[model samples]
Target: MAHITFLLVVVIITALAFDFTNGFHDTANAMATSIATGALRPRVAVLVSAVLNVVGAFLSTAVAKTISGGIVNDGLITLGMIFAGLVGAILWNLLTWLLGLPSSSSHALIGGLIGAAWVGAGLRAVDFYEVLEKIIIPAFAAPLVAGLAALLATRLAYRLSGRADEESVTRGFRFGQIGSASLVSLAHGTNDAQKTMGVITLSLISAGALPTGSGPPTWVVLTAGLAIGLGTYLGGWRIIRTLGRGLTDIRSPQGFAAETASATVILTSAHLGFALSTTQVCSGSIIGAGLGRRRAQVRWSTAGRMAVAWLITLPAAGLIGGAASAVVVHGGTAGTVAVAVVAVAAASLIYLLSRRSPVTADNVNDARNVTVNPQPAPASN
Candidate 1:
């Protein structure tokens, strides 16, 4: 370990903050279907997901290595740039959450880092090839694969149970959802939590606290795990409603297929060191699951909105990250302080606005809560 600077401290804390948001934002990825199907109560689902997330964090560090060394030239960047990137990621996560959109938290973090690196150290600092190879290609491919798999699995599940008692089949599938959803949660920890570990490790390397290319230390893994686990326990009910009920009306069979497909895809990507988006994969699976069930309707309107959010996640977060980098890199301590204050203010505003029409474990499954609705103006005669 090398000397830890104040800026380094800020970067690590910000990275963990981003990780916390990642947990809640992507909680729907694992537990949404299960909750929607009543396989588990909302609070219980999140609690189970939260615990699996912590345990999954200790499973692997391959994705962490990729973040620390593969995407950008850590040699060319500084602690300020990293902090700026984290700020961008955090803001995007919060904004999308407020809208009940299941955009990609993984992409937000990657795009922020890319934009900050490009601004701070010029284009040379960003490895475009690695970005395309590791992040871009997988982003498009993984979801489609998961969706297709879920579709097939759902079809097969129904076919096999066609002659069985409908009530018993639904009940059995619901029971199975607990296990499948748990696997997705474990997979979520393996992939998403490692991303924060990677970011923190990158900051450590930039600050000379760890040698370049070193993986996250023990403390980094533990803290990242705990932060995300806590966030998972809190849950993101707004997004959960969007995924669970908005995208499609999920039954136990469809929920089981979706969760199984999502878990398989996410776990495979984590092993291969691809920082894929669990949100996208899970959403795609839900859509597939909808298409598989007879007479089930996939809401393209809500899906369209979600798709647009996903398409813009990278560039949107990048622009914010680039702008933030300019301020932090050019303004010194005062600049960092200013960025922090603005971020806090913005986050607070989102939180307060969310409370005006709050979604919680209690009403997360209500049909009216399918999407995040703005508060209705007072009625006038």
Candidate 2:
């Protein structure tokens, strides 16, 4: 009993650490375009994202419930398995952050759970059908749908406001960007923070802290929300640089459209208990918005890199989690200490590397070849 209690505490702390990374890692999904377009200052944009994230957490926990209930058959899962899964997710997040790849944090977590569970209790531990219906189908579909929506919204915003002064249109849309970005942030909270909540709750379930089949407790919700909010404020500028300027050139109107599209898709997914990847969905939307402009340049190399990252995220995270789980389950307390030491060392190394190539608000805008909200060059009729 004592061992189980202690491990549960350790898992909770680790889960929040992962949640913090999740926040900064995916913050770009909500604010990258706004920052690129001067719709909001970088600091201000992240602050709004942080707050809305907290509010969004309260919007629903259907996704959380799915995570807590769906992916792995909870009856066969143990506390060590959950811990191993979190380790896998934390490691993957750090690796991607170092490489400036905008991978899906949500998928990493899901994969970790899947891998850990499979190792602990074999294939029967996985609820493949539910995983297929809820996670897999949307994994392929959400991004395309989000991108198309963004493309159409961009076309509409331009068509309706085409007659307005270029400066006026930008000014008006900047205000609109704030509102839309807020929605994206809120939607993010509903989706991302709940992932941690689900993990923590599952940890509790594995440790028998909560009765089986219960959603996350209020305390669990608040802690998960706060961890992610703090991470959002810290801001992963490397990821932001890749997203804001690398994938696409975001003008004010396009930024506005992309954010609006992301918010709608994510909110709907969370409501439906589908934990969609904000990184993928938002990145796709940005690319689609870029394509909406006839004269805009879209960078295919960066997009390809992101797609590759997406393909590997789940399985990579799972393998890491599976290995870690086996060690922790058999080795006990010393193993826990060893895992902690490894995590701290890896996190510290990533931090040191981040300083060498820092990305800030001033430099973030400089990364792009284009500036905010330019007049589209007249096309040949």
Candidate 3:
């Protein structure tokens, strides 16, 4: 009993740690465009995002229920498996952040849980149908739908204001960007924070502390919200640079359109209990907004890299999770300790490497260093 209690404590703490990483990693999804367009200062953007994230966490538990009950069979999952899965997710989040890649934290968590469950309890432990209906399908569809919406919105926004004064339009949209970006931040909290809550709830269920099919406890919700909020406040400056400046150059109008589109898609998915990737949704929206504007350029190079990262996020995190689970299942407490130590060490190394070329708020909006081909000049009559 004492052993089970101790393991549960460890699992809960590790789950919160993963939640913290998810917060910072995905913060760019909400505030990147606003910061990029100077609609909000980098620090102010993150602070607003952090507060809205906590408020958003209390809005819905539908996504949390999906995570706790929809992914894997709780009956066969163990505390060690949960811990190992968190390790996998955390490592992937840190790796992507270090590289300035905006991969899906939702996918990382899902893949980690899937891999750990598969290795710990065989294939039968996973609910493939639910994963398809809730996770996989949403993963592909959310971004496309959000992209199209953003494209249309951007075109319409420009069309409606085409004859208006450019300066006034820019200022108006810059102000609008704040509200739209805040919506994205709130939507992010409602969607992403629930993932950690679900994980913690699942762990409690596996530990026999909570009944099977139960929602996240109140304390679980509060702590998970706080963990993620704190992480958001710290900011993921590396990823902010990537999303804000790497993918495309954003103007105030496009930022407004993109953020509005992203928020709508994310909020809808969360309401439906689909664990959609906010990063993918927001990235797609930004690209679409770029395309909608005349003469605007999308950095296909940076975008291609991000797409590749998204494609591999699930399988990559899963492999790590599976290996970690195998170790824990075979070597027990000692193995868990060893895996945790190695994960911490790896994370530290990545942080140190990132410091060599840090991306802080002070320079997050520095001129784009990557060379992009200039759009060809329009042909003269």
Candidate 4:
């Protein structure tokens, strides 16, 4: 019984750690454009994001319900299984963070839970139908729709502003970007933070601390919400650099378009109980915003690498989760101890490494252009 309780503690702690990483790692999704376009200063942008995120966490519990019961069989999930699953997710998140890839921490957690459940309790432990209906279908659709919307919106904005003075137009759009970016931040918290809350809720349920199938409780919501918001305040400068700089230059207009697009998709997904990837949606909008410009360059190589990372995150984390679950079931208390040791070592190492290549607010906007050639081929030449 004590062992079970200990595992439950680990699962909750690990889930919060993942939530913290999720906040900083994905902050760029909502506020990067605002920062890039000078719509909001770095400090102001994060502050807004943090506050909106906290408020957003209270808006909807539909996604939380989906998570508590949708991805894995809540009944089959023991506290040990939950702990093992979180281990897989935290490792994947750290790995992607080091590479400066804006991969989906949400998907990592889902994949881990699915994998651990499958390994520990067999294939019957999963609900493939719900996973497909909820996660898989929305995963493809959300980003594409958001990206196209931003593309059309960008085109319209440029066409309307063609006769305006450049400085005035940029200034006007900067103001608009702040409002839209704040919406995206709030939308992000509503969607992203809830996933962690659901995980904790699921842990509580499996441990018999809560009912078998219920949405995240009030305490779960508040703590997870605050943890993620705090992490957002810290910010994910490496990813902010990659997003704000790497994926085509983001101007005030582009920033406005991207934030608008991201907000639409994120809010829509939350309403429908779909667990969409904000990272992918934001990246796609960034790409789409680039395409909206006539001469803007799209670095397909960087995008290609990101696509590969997305393709691999789920299955790779799943394998780790499955293996971890197997050892956890066999070794019991000893395995829990080992998992703790590994978690500490891994977390310490990643923190030390990040300190070496520290990306701060000062250098977060430094452009790392991929193309050497300045001009592009004419469309109708």
User: lDDT per residue, candidate 1, 259-332, as tens digits?
Assistant: 99998888787677666788999999999999999999999999999989998898888888899999998998
- Ranking the candidates on TM-score from highest down gives 1, 3, 4, 2
Question: Residue 379: error of model 3 in Å?
Answer: 36
lDDT of model 4 at position 234: 89
Off by over 4 Å in 2: 59-63, 66-69, 368-381
The candidate that wins on lDDT is 1
Alpha-carbon shift of residue 85 in model 2 (angstroms): 0.3
Arranged by lDDT with the best first, the candidates are 1, 3, 2, 4
Highest-scoring model, TM-score: 1
On a 0 to 100 scale, what is the lDDT of residue 85 in model 1?
Answer: 85
- Each prediction's Cα lDDT score? 0.87, 0.83, 0.86, 0.80
Off by over 4 Å in 1: 1-4, 61-63, 66-69, 211-214, 368-381
Over the stretch 80-141, how does candidate 2's per-residue lDDT look in tens digits?
78888888998899888877788989888888888888887789989888778767788789
Give model 3's TM-score versus the native structure.
0.92
Candidate 4 structure quality by residue, lDDT tens digits, 204-309: 8777888877778888888899989999998887777777777788788888998888888877776675668888899889888988977888788778878888
Q: State model 2's lDDT.
A: 0.83
Expressed as tens digits, the lDDT of each residue in 1-381 for candidate 3 is 887887788889988999899999988999999999999999999999999999989887674454544677766878898888888899999999988899999788878888999999999989899877877788789889998999999999999999657888899999999998988888888877887888788778778899888888899889999999999988998889888888788888899999999988887876675667889999999999998899999999898888899988888888899999999999888888888889889889988877766778898888453212223551320
Better of 2 and 3 by TM-score: 3
Clashing pairs in 3: none
* Residue range with the least summed lDDT across 10 consecutive positions in model 1: 372-381
- Cα shift from native, residue 80, model 4 (Å): 1.0
User: Candidate 3 lDDT (Cα, whole model)?
Assistant: 0.86
